[model samples]
Target: MSRIPVLTPETATPAQAEIFAKTVAKFGKNPLLMSTMTNSPAMMNSYLTLFQNLTDGRFDKKLARKIGLAIGEENGCEYCISLLAAIAKLQKLTDEDIELARHGKSTDAKEEALLTFVLLLVRHKGDLTNAEVQAVKDAGWSDEDVSEVFGHLILNFLTNYFWKVARTDIDFPVLRLYDQSKIARGNH
Candidate 1:
């Protein structure tokens, strides 16, 4: 059970109801994360809007999902991990790559560098050293890309923190198949 009650589509306000409807329409089901967000309809709406606007057609959804999964793993947020894993799969990321990113390993150099930077940011709570920033830049990311990375980190942090606080249930199939040992060990 969730620590807080999830506001269902029936009980939600018109705005919340519409959001839920839109979610179901776009994704085929209202994600558990959306249910968690219903704790405060206004907040949920704002968050949903931000999620839709920021990620609409801007960045590579696959890369963004991988980044989110990395942050979720570092935070030990199983709910967020599962949620992003589903999104990653929709973006065509292989199961192996998803597992690897969750475990803080990526075969691709760019992915490896991105995950390393994100993990370090999470470890230090965004207090990155100049050298760390330089390393990311040296890895061929432009200053604009670096800024966008921070944006992704901030977005992931919000959702991950919500997952921790809400203790949302894992409703997605891929997330349901997560290895218990890996989760218990905080390894992924």
Candidate 2:
């Protein structure tokens, strides 16, 4: 059960209702995060718009999802990790790739470097060293690419933080790479 109640469309304010409708129209379902944003309707609209625009058919969605999953793992957000793992699979990411990304490892050098950079950013909350930035650049990422990766990282952080606050339920399949026993032992 969720620690914070999920606000359904019926219970949402007018602003939230519209956002919920548009979200379902676009994504085929109202996302769990949106459902949890009922307390702040304006914040919900802003968040929905930000996410929609960020994912608006520019970059490879699969790669973005992989980045999100990797960040979720690093953040230890079970709900976000599980949801993005499912999204990665739906985007045709291989089981091995998903597992690797979830653990912040990737077979591709560029991807590995990207995840490493993201991990450093999350670990330090943007207090990245010059060496860290140079490592990503050396891995062939332009400044624009780094910025895009940061955008996805921010998105993942928002969702993961919300999940942490709401104690959201896992609405997607658990990734095989996640060891439930270890999580339980850690009291997470």
Candidate 3:
């Protein structure tokens, strides 16, 4: 059960309602995470801003989705895995691709490098040696790519922590990684 009630835009405060509309426009639906976030307008807006900044920039959608999946899976948040998987499907990611991304492996070399970089954070709990950073660069990702990885991970962490703290109900069908080790870098 969610620790808080999930509110639809119609029932939300004005600012939250506007953000809910933005969420719907962005994702086609106001997900449970969005509804849950309606509790705080500032939070909703902050989330919306970060999402837009990351997506509107030069992010490769495929890589971004894969990064999201890796973060969700490694952190063990079911809600996030399900939500991200569904979104990835909407972006035309094949089931094969989604599966590969769950473990941070990809047939695409660039995606593989990015996923590896993001996964290192989860696996090592954010401890990175300089050599580790250089390896991602050696794989051909630029410093800009690394900076965006931080943005994506920060986004992932928000929902991961939300799931951990709320134990929110699974609104998405639930994308369970092969291992029950759990999922969610955030609720979404």
Candidate 4:
């Protein structure tokens, strides 16, 4: 049971419906996250803006999907994990690739470096060490790439936080998230 009602195109305001329409055109469906976000027009606009910037930015679509999968796993957000998994599949990500992202790794060296930075960023709440930033840059990422990465991270943060607060219904294919800490404790 979601704490907040997930608005549909019929029930949403004109501005909210516009967001949903755009989402449907892009992802082929209006995800419940954006639907529930209609409660705050500011957040909805911000999310849409950030999403557009990242999608059109320097990162490859596949790389961005990997980063989103990593964020879902790190945050232990079931809604996000499922949503990103579906998007990743649509983006042609293999199960192997999704698994690697969940573990904060990638066969591509540059991608791995970005994932490592994101893992550290999420774990430390953005208090990245200078060396960590330097390492990401060493992997051929520019300062602009760093900024775009932050945009993606912020988007993930918003999604995860919204899920925590609103408990929106998960509309994507069901996907499970691993508890990294419990795995570290040898409990999984």
Candidate maximizing TM-score: 3
- Order candidates by TM-score, high to low: 3, 4, 2, 1
- Model 1, residue 70: displacement in angstroms? 0.5
Task: Provide the RMSD of all predictions against the true structure, rounded to 1 decimal.
Answer: 3.6, 2.7, 3.0, 3.7
For residues 150-183, could you state the per-residue lDDT of candidate 4 as single tens digits? 8989998899777766777678787776764522
The residue-by-residue lDDT of candidate 3 on 88-182, one tens digit each, is: 99899999999999989999887787788899977898798998888889998898888878889988888877766666677777776676646
Query: Candidate 3, which segments miss by more than 4 Å at Cα?
Result: 183-188
Candidate 1 per-residue C-alpha lDDT over 127-149 given as tens digits, one digit per residue, 9 for 90 to 100: 99999988888887777777777
* Candidate with the greatest lDDT versus the true structure: 4
Q: After best superposition, candidate 4 residue 152: deviation in angstroms?
A: 0.6
The TM-score of predicted model 3 comes to 0.90
Instruction: Candidate 3: give the clashing pairs.
Output: 76-182, 76-183, 76-184, 77-183, 77-184, 78-183, 159-186, 159-187, 160-185, 160-186
TM-score of every candidate relative to the true structure: 0.85, 0.87, 0.90, 0.89
Local error of candidate 2 at residue 68 (angstroms): 0.2
How far is 73's C-alpha from truth in model 4 (Å)? 1.1
lDDT of 1 at 164: 67
**Candidate 2 runs further than 4 Å off:** 176-188
User: Candidate 3 deviates by what RMSD?
Assistant: 3.0
- Ranked by TM-score, the better of candidates 2 and 3 is 3
lDDT of each: 0.76, 0.76, 0.82, 0.82
